[model samples]
Target: MNRKQEETETPSKYMNQMIRQQQKQLLRLLRKAGVMPDERIEVRDSELLIGLFSQIRRLPEFAEDKKKAAMLMHAMDTIFKFPVSRATVQKIYYRNKDF
Candidate 1:
């Protein structure tokens, strides 16, 4: 309603949108990589997420665009502990020719 209120609301809304975008990107990355976990993953803490990110970050083929996809997955894993399935990763491979 007021100028200050509008400014505050805008940032909050933007941040929320950014968070949602990150989550969506993460899910898409996992789907592309065939890493959807069978069971729902519970987020314990940032440590587990850091570890997961490290794991994917070390993948040899994960460079350039692939690296971006991996980073998105890592963020999702860290924020929400999303589980990835190997089968899903394989499916993604076939879906994309460059992969």
Candidate 2:
């Protein structure tokens, strides 16, 4: 390709500026919800929490109570910290001791 075409193929400064603007827009949308600042989200009732805890108890994979507690704690942290991701979940699962 010619020099002019090559320059156009590369992302221009204006393109970078536009990308930043879009990212800011997304952040603004998230801020409108109560989720961005790591606020404690209240559940409906004690029963709900109990149900959740019970469901966790039924999972067959955790070999010990400590590991189960660690995994559950990691899951809760992930649910609050940012958007959920499988890789992030796995990372938290393995890194539970550090938390």
Candidate 3:
């Protein structure tokens, strides 16, 4: 690729890596907080997990921990490139309750 192409692509690549790292961190936090059972969660189930995280963040226990709550919010914001509505999250959570 040309230098211009490489330059343009580098930021996108870096951003993707950063996002993946954030996701890993978020997963660790969720597991530590007993919000997730496993270290590896499917991408398709992300919406459900996001909804659960949102609920957990709202809990008095998590709310009191500003740092963790902020991390969760950041993770949620980074995960969805497009805006995801609360109603959509709730629907995903309900539909995948068994997950």
Candidate of highest lDDT = 3
Give candidate 1 misplaced runs (Cα > 4 Å). 1-40, 64-67, 74-99
Q: What do the candidate models score in CA lDDT, each in turn?
A: 0.54, 0.55, 0.63
What is candidate 2's CA lDDT for residue 76?
A: 61
What range of 10 consecutive residues in model 1 has the weakest lDDT sum? Answer: 90-99
lDDT of 3 by residue, 1-99 (tens): 458868876556667799889979998899899998653323555565676776777779777887777676666654553245646654553342442
Count: clashes, candidate 1: 9
Residue-wise C-alpha lDDT for candidate 1, range 1-99, written one tens digit per residue: 458868776556667799889988997888778897434456445344545554554456564457575566644544453344534433433243331
Instruction: Give the TM-score comparing model 3 with the true structure, all chains together.
Output: 0.31
Top of the candidates by TM-score: 3
lDDT of 2 by residue, 10-97 (tens): 6667776999799777767787885575464544343344345445644576545666866675556435433445464445444423
- For each candidate in turn, the TM-score is 0.28, 0.30, 0.31
* TM-score of candidate 1 versus the correct structure, residues matched by position: 0.28
Candidate 2 has which clashing residue pairs, if any?
A: none
